[model samples]
Target: MTTETTETTGTEAADIQAIKEIVATVQRTQRAKDPEGFLALFHPDALWTTGHGKVLIGLDAIAEFTRAVLPAANWEGEVTYEPVHIQFLRPDVAAVKVRQVYRSAEEESEGAPLYVMTKRGDGKWLLHACQNTQVQAG
Candidate 1:
């Protein structure tokens, strides 16, 4: 799906691009199993829900989870994150819908993740409240 934006101003466009980059970084970090890199994309008090429904609140909790799981994840795949939709809730806040796909030699899987991002004072967008949901085959 194409990205949906509420406004198309120059600033909004730039924000969209920045958000996309963040999503791209997520894909890179996941594929490389770089927990620190992945965690760096989040806000300090971010809230994250894993595809399996584990809830992680705050950066500390997320760090703990990432450290334990990422390096030990038993999988080999290429992961991609495509921004399907982006809605600007305010000048500094946005809701982004992503289409995530993981492809391995054996099979492929998908996920639909909604990320609520907030722009910091430095004009950097960071993931705030996010939910990762696995897409089941019908």
Candidate 2:
């Protein structure tokens, strides 16, 4: 489901911190190749989009996808959140823009630009939806 970010002036520091934590958690899990851990940070009804209509709905699908993608080879990378931009939709929801660069065990580093929207659940922020694209250098 698509959501329009609410127009508001002052955003809360706690909410911004929460969003940052979730983004960091996702990157950590990817580096660890921990599917269950990665899936735990997402909402039960999350929509994970990996470009070109590749969408995984629900936590189970996301878990499967993570396991399939992350374990093929030993992988490690550093993801830097360059100028992360957070937009508050409500007190309990936010959208964040992040820039990530990843390097696998055998591949060169590549950058990707992403937008991830998260909802606060039971005092924690859980990713709800995401849109991303690879940053290609010409």
Candidate 1, 21-85: lDDT as tens digits = 99999989999999999999999999999999999999999999999999898988688999999
RMSD in order of candidates? 0.9, 5.2
User: What is the overall TM-score of model 1 with all chains considered together?
Assistant: 0.96
lDDT of candidate 1 vs native?
A: 0.95
Worst 10 residues of 1 by lDDT: 1-10
User: Per-residue alpha-carbon lDDT of model 2 for 23-104, expressed as tens digits?
Assistant: 7777777667778887888788888877445788888887888789866735555554442577766677666777777655
Q: What is the lDDT of residue 43 in candidate 1?
A: 98
Model 2 segments more than 4 A misplaced:
1-11, 51-53, 73-77, 81-83, 103-109, 113-115
